[model samples]
Target chain A: MKKNFKLVIEYDGTNYAGWQRQNNAITVQKILEEVLEKLTGRNINVIGCSRTDSGVHARGFICNFVTETTIPPSKIKYAINNLLPNDIVILDSSEVPINFHSRYNCIKKTYTYTILNREEPAAINRNYVYHFKRPLDIDLMKKGSEFLIGTHEFDSFRKIGSSVKTTTRTIYSIDIEKQEYYIKFNITGNGFLYNMVRIIVGTLLDVGVGKMTPESVKEILLAKDRSKAGMSLPAQGLCLEKIYY
Target chain B: MKKNFKLVIEYDGTNYAGWQRQNNAITVQKILEEVLEKLTGRNINVIGCSRTDSGVHARGFICNFVTETTIPPSKIKYAINNLLPNDIVILDSSEVPINFHSRYNCIKKTYTYTILNREEPAAINRNYVYHFKRPLDIDLMKKGSEFLIGTHEFDSFRKIGSSVKTTTRTIYSIDIEKQEYYIKFNITGNGFLYNMVRIIVGTLLDVGVGKMTPESVKEILLAKDRSKAGMSLPAQGLCLEKIYY
Candidate 1:
């Protein structure tokens, strides 16, 4: 009998090509599928809830797969973690309804972007943060972020070559916070377009650093032109923080 | 006129040979001296407060040097950090008296050792923390640490080939705390012998696991033999946290 299981994963995506499986490079999905094959002794395809970008970290990612192995649900996470590499951790696993789909059942998603705004760049967290040597105006960034909140068409923040049929997406909220030398931008949305989170963060950073005025964010969103927005931020600073279903 | 200056440095020592200047390999001191030459147009020697081993990180390392550069002490840190690599940062700098010596005038030092106490090894902090897969008894580790606190002859914890003339060192405190899956051991002392902090942490970890009894720690100290102590922990887990003058 085949059993369907839901898996929650965490990974430092620095070495991964991305979450999607490809023949040329290593990916989180490929590794998960391979590990599942080894555990079940059968070829399987694992479907991820999100296709996180290369070099982007994830604290709570979800995936689903069907297996014929006799191993119980509780022991699957423990068993998989033992064989997985240090960068990839199977945080939790459980049996789900056979028809449950990790992607289609998702209600909301949250992403966080970290910026190290200090004179000296970060020494230890360089890979997890973007080192920007400037004092950012958090208040201005917050004011500019307010323009991005609420449901709207986010075509300006979407990548040029994205395959999505629609450019409209609803941003639920954007929270800007400053802790010591780190600036964190937590953004929640119904769905994000290709490179939407990074583009939004980049646009907000431009407003914080005086490159662009806070009022410019509104015009950029209205224009619906990708060139009106700032350059997309690096993937290292972006993390897939959480997913709700 | 030459001026003496003190610098508080932070570095990810994963790639460094050590804090000391050596003819072979890349050391922190060698890179600082080279950067100083570029900044001041004069060859200079930097005297560090402690000689940290290779792969040991530092958040607040102290060092002193004399130079004839006309750059103000307040701006020196900013200038030097620009030339230094991303992994090394000069956190602070100040002008000190001509006779000020970072190594001689230091009154206390603090170091922190981090252990990822979980089934899976860390991917994000792979260079900064040690991964130990076992159900560590924190209470037992804490109890064992009590015997090593206060002033004691730490000959058992000292590494072999150490040229220290005296084996006696006074430990001010040992703070052991477990947060989630991370265990941090912060130790403060008047002075530490070679590999003293690492060896102490290793012994406590052995106690945390069922490998050694907590009460056996006292007997190991009394034995005054290096062979009686546990193996020294990896250097990557150790960090020179702070130096108090």
Candidate 2:
């Protein structure tokens, strides 16, 4: 019997080329599809809810695929985990309705960018955070993030060559918190463009370091030019934290 | 003019063979010595305070070296960091007395072992923690750890192949703290055996999982036999946290 399965995944994307499969690079989608195909003895295409960039980690990424194997949903998770590498883990798996679509049904997505705000580099968490040696003003960063909330045209934050038809997007909230040497930025929205979270975090970091003023972020948004905003930071610091469906 | 210098070092240890220099494998000491030899016009031997096993991390491993260069000690930290790999960092460097020795002058050392006691495998901290899937009873572990406090002839916890004349050591304190999924064991002592911290943690984990009783640890200590205690845990979870001069 063919059944639609929903899987929530966690991966430390340091070694992967991203979620999309490529001919020359290893990707999460390629490995997952190969594992499914080997188990079910049929070619399969695993559909991911979002296309994460290279080196972007995920704690709760959602995906869907149809399989004809008689293995139970709970057992499939265990089987796949045993075959997959240590960096990728299946957090949960369940059978979904035949009409269910992971991408279309995703109501909201949340991303988190972690920055190690310290003079010394982090030894253990080097792959998980972006180390910024300079001091950052948390109050200024928070004030700058307020301009990112609510609906707006996020053209300035998106990558210049992105192929999205519309640059407008709705943001639900933005939260910034500090714990000792770590500064985390959590942003929730209906959708994100290419490198949107990283660019926004980069701009906010500029504000925190006194390179840019808080009110100038509004003008950058109004300008709708990618060059007016801060450059996109490294993908290793960004993570797909959670998704609501 | 020759000058003695002290360096505080930090390393991830995931890809290292150990702190001591080896013939076929890469070690922390070898890298430091090579970097110093290149910087100065002389062959250097960086003497570390401790000889950590393969895969053991360090946040504050102390070492010393003598050089004839006129480079300021403060400038060496930045220069070495720029030349060294990302996994190793020189946290601080300073001039020390010519008679000072890192091993003999070290009065106290603290080591920390981190355990991810959870059902799921650790994704982000896979290289820094030991993943124990079974449920661990903290009270039982703590009770077992009490037997290891204070001065004791720790022959049972020492590695079988080590060549120490006397197996006596003094432990100043042992602190156990749990934060969410992580359980950290910090042990401060005048000196540690070849595998003392790993063996003690392994024994405590055995007690936590009902493989052994808390009272058995006392008997194991009294026996002074290496076979009486649990096996030494992996070196990846152990870290040299700090040192007192």
Candidate 3:
């Protein structure tokens, strides 16, 4: 009998070359497929909900695959997790409908970016956050984020050379919070273009640091030019937080 | 003119061979001294407050060194931080009296040991915490820790074959708190023997898992034999948190 297994994964992407499989680099997808092949004695094809960039982490990533192994679905997580490295963990596994596709069936996705807004750089969490030395105005950043709350053509907030069927996307929310010296941005959207979230965060950071006005973000979005947007932030600060099916 | 400078440092000890300088191993002291030598163009010796084991982290580690350089104390941190690796950071630097020393002037110290008590081990914080699969009884651990408070001879908790001037130490308090799946043991004491904190945490874990009763900790202390105590936990879970002068 053929069974479709959905897996909830958590990974520290510091050492991986992103979610996609590549011939010259180690990736999360390749590692997962190898582990599954070892466990089931067959070649495996795993589909990830998002193609997280190199050095971007994930706490609640979703993926799926089909297998004909006799191992129970409930036991698959434990078996594969033991064989995987310490940086990637299979949090949960369940049998799903055969037609289920992790990427095509995803309804919403959430991502978070963290900045260590302090004078000194962090040592313990150096690989997990972006260290920004200047003081930021949270109010201005929040005001600027409001312009990104609804549907908009996000060409200005995407990678310059990236292409997609449509540049329009719906942003459900953008919540910014600060605790002590750490600032976190939580964003939920139906879809995001290449480097979209990082570019958005960079634009908001510019607003916070008085480099750009809060209302200027509206103009930047309307311009639809990647050069008019803020600099794209580093990938280490971004994390795939959740995906709603 | 010779001036003494005190530094507050933070380090992720995942890649070093402990705090002391050794001929065959890379250590924190060696790195800091090398950085200082590069900055000041002279041989420098740094004295640390504690001799942490390999893979042990620190957030507020104190150290002191005397130098004749003309750089301001406030600028030293920024200058050295730029040259040090990302895993080590100098958080603060200030001029201290010539007679002041980081080790001799320290009056109290705080260390924290973190355990991830859950079915699945952590992926993101794999290097910073000990992943224990068994569910721990926080209440039982707290009860057992009470026997270790106040002044006592901690010979049983020290590492076997490790010699110290005195086995007597004063533990001010041991606070155990569980947030989500992480159980943190914060211990404040006047001094700690070699591997004392790790051994004490291991003994408490034994009490938490019903392997030993809370009352048995008293017997272990009274026995003053290393074999009477529980196992010494791994070094990664222990961190030097603070030093009070």
The interface RMSD value for candidate 3 stands at 0.7
The lDDT of each candidate is 0.91, 0.92, 0.94
Q: For each model in turn, which proportion of the native inter-chain contacts is also found?
A: 0.65, 0.47, 0.84
Model 3, residue pairs in steric clash:
none
The TM-score values for the models, in the order shown, are 0.83, 0.94, 0.93
Predictions in order: chain A TM-score: 0.98, 0.98, 0.99
Question: What's the C-alpha lDDT at position A81 in model 3?
Answer: 94
* Cα lDDT over the full model 3: 0.94
Q: Model 2: how large is the Cα RMSD against the reference?
A: 2.1
- Residue-wise lDDT of candidate 3 within A1-245, one digit each (tens)? 99999999999999999999988999999999999999999999999998998999998999999989888998899999999999999988999999999999998999999999989999987888999998999999999999999999999999988879999999999999998889999999999999999999999989999999999999999999999999999989999999999
Query: What tens-digit string does per-residue lDDT give for candidate 1 at B1-245?
Result: 98999999999999999899888899999999999999888889899999999999999999999988889998899999989998999989999999999999999999999999987677667888998988899999999999988888999999998888799999999999898888999999999999999999999989999799999999999999999999899999999999998
Regarding TM-score, does 1 or 3 come out ahead?
Answer: 3
Q: Individual DockQ of the candidates?
A: 0.55, 0.56, 0.77
**What's the true lDDT of residue A50 in model 2?**
92
Ranking, lDDT, top scorer first: 3, 2, 1
Q: Pick the candidate with the highest DockQ.
A: 3
lDDT of 2 at A107: 89
- RMSD of each predicted structure: 3.8, 2.1, 2.2
**CA shift at A110, candidate 3, in angstroms?**
2.1
Q: Give the winner by TM-score: 1 or 2.
A: 2
